[model samples]
Target: MHDDEEMLRRLRVDDLPPSMVDLNRAMRAGRRRERMGAVVAGGLAAVLALGTVVVVAATTGKNTAAPWPGAGPEGSRSPEPAPPLGNCTIDEAPVASQSRMIKIVANRSGQVFVMQDPLKSGNLLRWMDGRQERIDGVPTGDGYGTAAAVNGSGAFVGASGYKPAWVYRDGTFTVLPLPPDVSAMSMVGINERGDLIGTAFYWDGRDDTRAVLWPASQQGTPVLLATPAGWSSEAMDIADDGTVVGYLSHRTDNGPVDITPMAWGLDGSARRLPVPAGWTPARAGKRGPYPIAIAGDWVVGAGARWNLRTGTAEVVEGLMPMKVDKYGRLFGNVPLSVPDNGSTSGRPAVWVNGDVQPLPIYPDRPEGTLFSVSLDGRRITGTSYVTSGAFGTATWTCGR
Candidate 1:
């Protein structure tokens, strides 16, 4: 296996504490099992199975320096576009944990934020009223459950590694219901009305996955969103009006053939978002144009931004977009590549009126990524790493 693929497999499939020897053994065992399955199938199915493996490996690799999808609330709201970022100040927000923060999300008002520590302990920390407290209701196990998105009322939704997807509200946890023949599900984004969007995986092993919507009532069954016949879909973010945005990828015996941004309306109709002329997947760091967040008529992704009203997309140069607030301010990171060492670092930044304004980084914690931006464009939260390789959650409060 290639070095990157090997690293991704270890990170995604194995949750046990790191041990090089044990990880190697586990990889070998996994390969042996795949080989035996191929022998048992012994035909077209075998080829397709191998292709699916490749797709999973490619998609599962985590980009630590890029902002995760659904990092902040993007429910339907009037655009309160802010002026281009000007002179601002920066400071570190206090947190209760010393472990690495895996994900951070904020409510529409930015008054409440949730941070998850997935490395050392799987605890969800809620920051409000200038203090931090542990959220008590999320179920935990061997591995950490992801805290995907939160709404204005402080209700949040997420999925666990060993348990079903759930929503925590009013100091209680409620498990989301799954559709028939689906064994596993994950909730990624929730809107103001309590509508939830996520993905459902099948049990038949055809590698079938579909984007699903769970209504606000919590008792209603999830509705499967529409997709093309041979393609698979995953919903990343949902708007207050029930619009969902994500990506669709089609795979074959060779591998993933195409990946493009897509959206579903309130009626469950799928519409393909146009890409910039002459742009291709190879131009997007081999990941294609994956939409991470949607607000109003705008959808922002790694290196592309599309306007749903005009049906046009423009290239977002030098920015891996993480969050787009209702005010149209774009928050992201500029990845700095080190050619000699083949490593990459990021500088936290925001785009104002198509101009890039780089945020200040502390001398002690120089490398970091921006995860959540306040609706008013005043506060941004992310993780910063020290020279010793330890990281902590921080928030940068900016002002005029």
Candidate 2:
């Protein structure tokens, strides 16, 4: 990714909010010698590799170097997966090698987008190895009805516009009609059953953002999910079982600002997951989860914290629970540490129950990382670069 230098530059500028401006200045005003090897927590992880499958070592006998528990592909010196409970791998590569710059989502299945790497431009979004589709009329940019979620068939792209949001299934954009002054809506995610979970707002959009479950048995107006008070919400990912999770802003009685993170579930009513106890003194914000599997009782998520521990949400610590293969096991905090030297303030480390393991990187720095475990307590994703390199938005999926 080419944005490290740019990330670093922006960190000095737009990275810190006005509230954090004083904190940044104070940290710099002090001497560097006092905090040279400090270890802070609560930062989000960024996936750095490009390819879908990344193997750094074989998973067999030479498990010494591999980060995973099983043997990797033949002839590949893979990082042995860690203990069964903590298996993982890391890989990072430049985005310029291949692939379009903008087509948006990038998993094994490809989509196209505008390329903006240095002198690159004019690239357009289209199907894999195909021509661009024509839209008779539509907007663009922040207000454009961008399709953020794809259905099981990949035929529909859930999109949103400045006005009503729509589901672009079967090549045509069908507006998800809502009755009476429904000014805004957008799709957040889809479940294995092809159900969509998202949000919609009114100019007087009720009290706050709503968590919407779509394909209404009958649609008069978009449904508003019950959420915690003062907890402004937006629906994010949805699980196969229909569990939803996202963020909420914490507030005081006097209506002042409070720490907020990717919040999931409501207070008391919803069975919210727990994080470190030090987050909020008033219990205004619940320890939000990412809804990984949502089994019988558990709702897992890429948990986020305000980091009373680190004093910054952009640089926090989290866990990547390992592959718990058998019973009576506890790998304990196989923590996913993040880069918070405050160099390039991109995203914070927010792995929920993700298994964290050390992987190959530039010599001399054990902290340089690139792999994060998913809350299934198994799957992993992350990024890595030697020399404490930079970041690009597309570089968020470089793990194996």
Candidate 3:
């Protein structure tokens, strides 16, 4: 880690000990420029569907099928399932749950399932499965549980239910306990090789937090990330090359705050990302690297900060900073601060790149959102809970 990058990371996080947000206007702007994607000659762009934790299963069963999530524009496919009606943030509501999820896994052939459900009391466990259901294995332990993980093949999940992180393989839950020095942990993500990384707290018991990575090789204790001493962190995503996105923290003169949208590497080098120019009054903090849906020199995630490039952060310019796709296209819709109370109003949106606005869903769906993107990033899957003024979750494959 260069001293300059460390300095930048610190400077970016000098305020706000906690979070980031500024997405509404960016979506509106992207909507104006969306265009349909190209139809390739059977290019193997497959979409595997499933759910993660805290979701009721969609009874509609079919392998290659579109959702029956009723009502879109005059002529288009049905939307995805609506979430249980409520005001949970996109992160709070889910396309999938710990029980089941569709991850665009990198190293496997065919779809996989990372399932989590309850036993008696607050105890929890994770069951991993590959192409076959018979090959099921479950990992169990203490604490209340929920599995927030990266799907596809090489996936990882952690439970508030358990103390250490676990890996799911072809029908097996490999319980990789943390080092004696590490205490509570959250498994944030896994690379293609199943290398797991997340935030960790040491047994020393302080308000301190650091990033930790446990390799599939199973040899060493979780290594602490080289970050500043006082701040805490939350690991959002990881890349095949092991780039981690989260935040850096510090207590400004006012109170404890965080420098959001920060990124770090496997080598312990960290850099604070710059906020977009659109932020109001030019605030200094940034938001996230939502999981780098696509990997490379560029990072991608769904978040909002003033687009400093355009000088709009403080002024209320209604758009968001969308995720960058492997194709280098960015798909961002409005954030949760729209006119219809932001959370519910189906702010009909589009994807923009310069002057193009490729529309996503029909003008009136239950609720419109651009939530968790796919690994390939060809599509984005958010929720549209139900028919109560734009109140649902919907995901769309970016198209023409």
Query: What C-alpha lDDT values do all the predictions have?
Result: 0.60, 0.33, 0.40
Q: After superposition, how far is residue 326 of candidate 1 from its true place, in Å?
A: 3.0
TM-score of candidate 3 to 2 decimals: 0.56
Higher TM-score: candidate 1 or 3? 1
Quality of model 3 by C-alpha lDDT: 0.40
**How does residue 221 of candidate 3 score in lDDT?**
56
Q: Write the per-residue lDDT of candidate 1 for residues 1-400, one digit (tens) a residue.
A: 6432332221221211111111133432353233212121001110000001000001112211111122345432223345666676666655543543245666654567776644336668777778777876577632466567788777888766634778888888787777788756656788889898887766476565688998776446888887657666778888877779987655545443455567777665566555554444444354566688877666787566765543445555556677776656678766644445544566677876567787887777776766566666787777666535566556777776
Clashing pairs in 1: none
TM-score of 1: 0.73
Q: Which is the winner by lDDT between candidate 1 and candidate 3?
A: 1
Q: Of 1 and 2, which scores higher on lDDT?
A: 1
Clashes (N, CA, C under 3 Å) per candidate:
0, 55, 76
Off by over 4 Å in 1: 1-82, 97-103, 116-123, 140-144, 217-219, 337-341
What C-alpha lDDT, on a 0 to 100 scale, does residue 329 get in candidate 1? Answer: 69
